[model samples]
Each structure stands twice: as C-alpha cells, then as structure tokens.
Target chain A: MRIKAIQWALSAAVLAMSASAFSAPPTPAMLSNACAGCHGTHGESAGPSMPALAGQSKISIVESMKGFKSGERPSTVMGRLSKGYSDAEFEAMGEFFSRQKPFTTSQTLDRAKVAKGAELHEKNCARCHVENGKEIKDNSPVMAGQWVKYLEIQMADYHSGKRKMFDRKAERMKPLSQSDLDAIAHFYASVK
Target chain B: MTIDRRSFLKMTAGAGAAGVLYGCASTGPSGSTADVMPKTGRRVVVVGGGYGGTIAAKYIRMMDKNIEVVLVERNDHFVSCPFSNLYIGGLMKDLSPLTIRYDKLAANHGIKLLQAEVTGVDAASRTVVTSKGTLKYDHLVLSPGIDFRTEEVKGYDIATTPEVIPHAWKAGPQTVLLRKQLEAMPDGGNVVLSIPLAPFRCPPGPYERTSMIAMFLKQHKPKSKIIVLDANPDIVSKKGLFLKGWKKHYEGIVDYRPAKKVTEVDARSKTVLVEGLEDVRGAVVNLIPPQRAGQIAVAAGLVGADKNWCPVNPTTFESTIHKGIHVIGDACVAGAMPKSGYSANSEAKACATNIVNMMNGREIVDFSGINTCYSFLSAKEAVEVTGVYKVDKEKNTIIAVPGTVGVSPDLSELEAIYAESWLKNILIEMST
Candidate 1:
C-alpha cells in the first residue's frame, strides 16, 4: 500500500508538470464545475451525505482519484466517474479544491457523542490525523468540519472491507464499534 | 398591423429561404410593438429558464462578468420534473420546495430576467422575438426543453384537455392534477400509464413513476393496480434493478406490458387503445406522448434531418445549422447521454465555458461531463445509474466513456439519501 501510494504521488507530480507545459489547458473552474451537480459550487457540498471537496489536501484528493480509477477503492459512483478524467485533470482539480476555504457543515451534532468522540480520536486516530484532524497534512484528508454522515459511511466502508485503508489505520479501526465510530465522526464534525 | 396565422407562416418560410441574402441587417418580422431590450457590450440571450438556461446564464457571468446575460423564460417559477413523481405518489408534501424562483439567480449573477414567451428566432438577423419585445444578441442560446407530439396519439389532445388525461411530464399543475386523480381513484381501480418510445425525456422516468404510484397504491388502495404500457420491447434503463424492485415491493400491484404501444385514447372513457392488443381502461390515464425539440428551437431551424432534436457541435453546444446559437438540455441530440436534469446541468457548464472561451479568442477545450440519475423503488430505497461522457471529435457528438458508465449493483437506503443530496446540491448550483 505504501509503495503504491509513493508511485501515485510520483506520477501525479509528473502529470502536474506536464499539464503546466500546455499553452492553455482548461481552467480549473471549467474542469471542476462538472462536479458541481453533486459536490456543490467550488466543491463545498450542500448535502450532508456528500463530502465537501473544498480545502482538501492536494495529495489526498489526487490519491483518492487514482484509487477510484484503479479499482483499488470501492465506491458507489466514483469508480465509474474517476475513470473519465485523466491524471492531469485530477492534479488540476486537486489544486483547485485545495485553494478554497474548507466547508463546515451546518447540521446539528450530538454534544454527548462529540465529547466522547474527542477522547476516542485522541486514543485511536490522533497519531495520523494530528491536531484533532484540523491541520491538513501531505497525505491526510481534512477531517475537521466534515459531514458526520459522510464520515460515518466512510468508516463503515473501511470496516466492511469495501474500501481499503493503510495497515496501521486499519489496525486502529479494528477495535472500534459502530457507536464508537459514530462518536468519532461527531467529534470530527464538531471541530469547526 | 395584425397578420393572420396563414400569412405569418408564409412570411416566415419566405424569410427562411432568403435568410442568407437578408443577413443581420434586416429585422425579419415585427412581433410585439414593445421596445426592444437595449444591448450593451457582448451579450448572450438565453431562452428558457430551466436547468440548462439558468446554469448557462449564471456560469457565463461567473466566467466573465463583462459579458451581459439575459435569461428569457415563460414562467416566473421553475418546477423541476426530477422529483415530481414523489409528489404524485404522495411522498412529497407540496411543490413549494421543488419550485425555485429566479430572483436569486438574477440578483446573485446580475442576469437580466425577461418573463416572456418566445415567438420566433431569426437566425440570420441575430434576434429573438418574444411576446414582450425583441432582443438582439451577439450569441443566442436556446434551451427550451421538449414539446409533445400529441397528434401522433390519435383522439388524445393534451393541449385541450390536460386535466382529463394528464401527461404530467413538465410537472407543476399537471403533477397536481395527476395526484388528485390517483387519490380519487377507487380501491380496485386501474391506473394506465402509456410511455412513449426511447429518446424521450428521462428514460427511466416512466418506470420510476410506476414504482412511486405503486407505492401509493400498495398503501392506500391495496387492490388497485397500475398498468404500464411501454412502447419499447423492454425497460430502457436500469432494467434489472427496476424489475427486481417491482418484484420485491410491488408484486401483483404493477402490471407491466412491454411493447404495448398506444394507438389512441378515449378521454371520456379513460381507455387506451394499444396496437396489436385489447384496450386498457383506467380511472386515471397518463399518456406521455412522442416529443420533439421545443417550439423555439424548431422555429429557429436548429433540428436536423430527424426533425425531433437539435444537432450541435458537442464541444460548444453551438447549433450545427445556425452559427452563434447554441442549444442544450433535452432539446439537443446528446449522443448516449440520457435526457435528465443532471445531464442538462453538466452540459450547461461545458457550454458556458466554451462560450466564454470563444468570446475571448481562447482555445475551446473538448467537452466532458457526468450524469447521475437516481430512481426511488420505494420511499426509502433507490437505485442509480451514472455515466461520464466525452465528445467524440469524429462523430461530433458526446459518447459515454467505455468504463465510466454503470448502474448500481443493488438498491439501498443509502443511495436514496444520496439521491436527495444530489437534488439539493444541484438546485443550489443552478438557482444560487
């Protein structure tokens, strides 16, 4: 998994460089506007189930596209959609989304679950998602202020083996029950 | 001077034959005597305020604020056809949530909203004649959606008696009428829904309507049945999923008879006469008749040999027959792309981008878009079909990429939630 991630990073970097060489490639807005139907204008999703793409880490976005395209990641629709875009388009979209302000859901969160979730995050997820998942890292997604429902769905996918995660992350997730994961999702959602 | 219908048709035909000779200098025909809308710099006048027109107007402004955009719509409010089935099935409470006002679009994007019926388009003159007045444009966009061919279905005149035999295809009042008819139907009554052939708006729509109506019947009128009369040999989209859903939830409630094409309808008796089959009687009859491009598109001579849909250069959505005029949404012949609101929204964005590029002398990029359509089998469970499309330069039309189109393996509640979210986000994108 680590080796594959490294290869994707390398190829994305090469593609990004080649994309800049074009005289006038499509503007990032033009490429990304195609996603506005579900992802919202500028990637700040209006719906709670869909994840907001605005302010996501460039590497994370690029990796997710590669994963979906290669069938290494299972998705309801992204697997098919990701196949349509080129690696260069993915790089452009990554840059485009990373520049926008992060979207914070306006949904009401359970206070008790959020309080419990903070503790769970520190114990299980703090190692990789540092700063309560607020600080965006090179390879990590920005979890703070994400939709709780979307987070819950992703966690379920990881548990069901529908989506593959890194070994250490998977190991940490193994012991967490559904309620525990729900609390963790609430905590992440409560960050903003 | 008031001209009769016969003379008007004759005058238009003469003008069409001599359009090239007349050029942009001649103002073809005088419509309303109202003053023409003053043109300011580079302007694009988009006719119709549906998904395609609204998004194109907004995105064009987003891309370049300098270019003036005018959106002309007949109706003041936009009622979506996407979720109207829910309303007809009694799942959705009212149409208020589905109806969107254009005020925000005008205020947020600085678009000029003209509520007027488009009478004609003089392509050579680069002007559109509406009931209110005439409007000149550097570029014109016609996204007028679809118009029904009621003549094909003999003895069924939707224009004259829509309340009696509702198509409810365009939503709004027709949707309300259909729901009312369903509610008034007796417990053991039949509801006959006749679907037109393929290439009609929303391929999976008739099936979804069937499921929704079945859901209503299974709850309120258990003994009631819905007779689905499809012209095609089989279901056009999500065939396996829809069949499975019907078998699982609506067994004995939905009587699906494929290849049963409607030949005529007796409105008074509420009976549908089918080809090669006996007549089917129903308390409520829904006849989705054959359709072509909207009146304005056809008047502009955008439709090609098919005479049903407009052919366009997929990259820019510019009309193949008429330069400087683009057509999008269900009105255009989008190869392999289903006629749905999502497809229209996607095409609108691509069209807007290309228009802005053309105006600024920039290179026009190839067109690429995504379409995701979800159909509810029941109130909670739903199935989806998604596709990613790109323009085939050789064919000059959009085609789905090989590995980028498929339906959901199965229906689920999660997909239903996603479906709602898709609608919400798309509404926000188009309206605000």
Candidate 2:
C-alpha cells in the first residue's frame, strides 16, 4: 500500500511539472490591451488631454500613418508603433475607427479661457475653422469636442518646428504665448 | 452601496436591448455564462486580466451591446505592475491603489470575468480549454503578458529557489517576497540586481526598481550597497536623468555595472555568475532573467525566433504564426517599442476596435497610437518618455508619427506629481 501511494504521488507530480512546459497563444485584442494606460477606454480620451480616436476620418488616419512610417512626420512613440504593422493593417484600422461614433468632449470649459480663446481663434483660426469652430472646410476635422490639451500640444509642436503643416492658419498661432493657446483650446472645447 | 438592477432589467426586457443597456450596463457579476447577458453568435474570450485583457473586454462590450464577452484570468483582483516600484521603494504603503476589483468592470460595462487558469487552445474549433471547462469563442483575444526564460539562467529555477532568491518581476506575491527579503537582509549587506536586455517589458523598469531599492537602503539600511548588473552597455531608457540621479543622490550606495550579463546562479551560496566578471555573492538577489512570450503563446506555435517571441501583423495584432490567434503584451514584438504598461494599454484599445469591427463585418481602417512612461528616481523626483506611433506601409511596421518622441529635460518634483496622477487616471480606466 505504501509503494502504491508513492507511485501515485510521483505520477501526479510529473504531470504537474510537465503542465507548465508550454502555454497557449493569446488573441489580437489581448495583445493590444496595453494602450488603455493613457488613451482611455475604447480609445476615448477621458483625461481631457489626449486626442479621441473614437471617431476620426480614415483618410486623416492613413495620411498621418504614412507620414509617421516614412519619417516625414516625427513622433516619440508613434514612429516605433508605425513600424510594427503591415501596410494593409493601417487601412483596416482607419476603417475600424472611422466606423465608431465620436466621443462627446463636454467637460465644463472655463468661461474666461473660452472667451480669450475665441478672440485668438477669430484673429487666427476662423479661415479654415468656420463659424464658432463648428464647420471646418477642406477635410479639416471638427474641433468642437476635441481635447483642449491635445490642441495646445499640437500648437506647440507647430511653433517648435517639430510638425510641419500646410495650413497657413496655424502659422498665425505660432507667435501666440502658451496662455493664449490654452485660451484658444478652452474656447474650442466650449464651442459645442 | 451595491445596487441590484437585475430586477429592474427583468421588468424592462421589452425596450430595445441596445437602448436599455446604453450607459447603464453593469448589472451582472463577471463569470458564469448564465450570469452575463445571453450569448449570441458574436462573442470574444480574452485571456490574461492585465492591462491588455481588461481593456479588450471592456472596450468590446462598449462597442456592441449584445456581444457576450468573457475574460479568463488566474487572479481575482487586478494588480498594476506600473506603479509597483513605489510600493517597493517604501514611499507607498497602501497597496489598495494598485489593485482593482473586476466587479466594477463587470457591473458597469457588462463584462464576464472568469477566474481560471487556461490549459489549452484549439485554434481550429475557436475554443479555449481552461481548468474549469471549455469555452467557445468567435474571437480569441490573448493578452497573456510575459514569462521569463528561466533556462537562460543556469542553476536558478523558480520552483526550487523562489523563496531565498526571489525575482519580483510580476506584481503579485513575487513583489511582496522580494520586499520581505530586502527588509530582512542585514545592514552593510550587498544586494545584487540583474537586469536583462531590451524587448523586455518596461525598458526602464529595472532602473526604477534599482533607484527604489537604493532609496529604501538609504532610509533604513544606510550601510547596505546595491550592485546593478545590467546586460546592456548602459542605461537603456531615460539615460541622462537616471545617470544624473545616480550621481547626485545614490552615488555611494549604488554600484552601477553595465555590460555585465548574469549567466548562472548559486542559490545556496547567494551568488550570481556573470559572463565576464567573477561570481559575486550577495545577501539578497533579484534576478530578472531574459523574457519571452507567455508559454501558451509558444505552445500554440505562434512564437518565432527559436520560440523566443511571437510576431504579429502590426495592423490587427493577429499572430502571423497562427490563423486566428492574436498576441499582445510582452509576448509579441513591436518594432522600436518597449513592452510597457503604457504601450500595452495603447495596443489593447486599437486591438479592441479592430476585433469589434471584424466581428460586425465592418471595414477596418488605420489608426495611430501613443505611449508615455514616467520613471521615478526617488519618492518625490521623476522623469518621463512620451511619443506618438503609427503604422508605416513601406517599412511594414509600427513607427513614430514624425518627430514627437520627447524625453524629460530633467528630473523634477513636478514630474513626480504627474507620475502619480498618471497612475491614478490609469487605475480609474482599468476599474471603472
């Protein structure tokens, strides 16, 4: 009886030891779950700083991607991430995100900041960004529900000669101070 | 207070399922198919409850109201590995912020969390076989994270020497184990910390950990010394700030040794055998060995390069090695990107969108992502690394979106405040 018990224990131990030898493969969604750290849930930016990818144009996404991959555009993390995917995947991603609805960015905008921003926007951004920053012309994205923080950062990027844009309208804001840019962003957030 | 809305849902099944579930979906507990919404043909089973898995489960449900989502993880409460260094550094005592209950995610987003160890995967049948039972999935999302390549370190086996020389790489029991060993070690003792090369999760994690340990030693065990045996030539990420930190603060306490690879271990004697240097003995050894894809990823034949890591299409994050299996986290290769929680969370959001679109037969489009990592040099001072990433067609990889990679100008107390805020917001995203 003692011998039998020892043998049984030995077999069970061996089975358990061998069980950890291999692990199953994970899914694509599991692989990509790492992005929620900063981007927010479902690619919706709740932190009021990051851009919302919930609803954006496919062409805009693809063009930005092409720029990143080719080194025409420079990014800290995106350049590395762009190098990870195949070309077809970029088009597919553009389609996927474009199909989703936009996240409503309606955090209470500071009235003073919005008023200051509106003054800046009237002098600089009203050309392409039409009345009240609502209707944007020439494939420009609607800035109404966009994150104020992202807008400020992009403006800084343009001013620093980091990102080059064809829009002459952005050139006017190149001379604005950080406070002015913040005011403009606050105004944009309040538009909707 | 816990609210039971199932009785109310029972009364209002007449309203459109989508409308009734709109914004108020957290009514059921996670786990058991009977408890969650009825399973339709559209279903996704996510493995590993880390940043990637949880984000996928939550986002997929948010995308579609009727799609039943099941998340399988071994642990009940989710622990964040991102801020665990603070806990080890003696700066953070309350561990409540690092952990999140799945009940909130299930109750709020209508997700089913299955606490079980997955045993096997049948790709053809689209079924995940777990210890509890088998589950059929229309789409299988695997965010199993990373596992160490233990065999690389000769004479050190996790099974045998787990207690004496613990590697608290994972954020759970292993972390506490390492902390206890550090606490128990006598003053004037030596701590030998071995760090692996790149493609490992959190390129800057090992350095941050070194700083934390050194900080603890300064406060409690002043005479103790920490020898960092780095496999890389120098500090891999956030170099200037860390080098400055070492010079300004931990100059005498830390013995930084770059280009020294730990090859072997003598657990009984508490010694680590380096490639070029003499065997160094210590009172405590934190050996973070070279890493690879989770064992499950290798077993499913999804791994590449001598079964070291998995290669997936950067677009969909689907395994190039397998038909339908998608791999993420520390398991797969992302070009020019470090495997960090920030990177994982970014990837999870994109992958979730792709999976939902593919399930509904909607068109898949391209999207860019970003990662921002903040490493603390001390309890009050920190630095940062932030960047934007996008898919490159000509290179066929995920690349940066042209000139946005920004490292910190210098370590600052303000950056430390930002770091804590980042952790707080990330925890909120994971839990609620």
What residue runs in model 2 are displaced by over 4 Å at the alpha carbon? A1-36, A42-192, B1-40
Query: How many clashes in each candidate?
Result: 0, 78
| Candidate number with greatest lDDT | 1
Error of 2 at A134 (Å): 17
Fraction of native A-B contacts kept, per candidate: 0.54, 0.17
Per-prediction TM-score to the true structure, in the order listed: 0.91, 0.69
Write one digit per residue (lDDT tens) for candidate 2, span B106-151.
Answer: 8998888888777666565455656555566767888888888888
State each model's C-alpha RMSD to the native. Answer: 8.2, 12.8
- lDDT by residue for model 1 (B189-283), tens: 99999999888999899999999999999999998999999999999999999999999999999999999999888888988899736888998
Query: Could you tell me how far off, in angstroms, the CA of residue B99 lies in candidate 1 after the best superposition?
Result: 1.7
CAPRI classification of candidate 2 = incorrect
List the pairs of residues colliding in candidate 1: none
Superposed on the true chain A, the predicted chain A of model 2 yields a TM-score of: 0.70
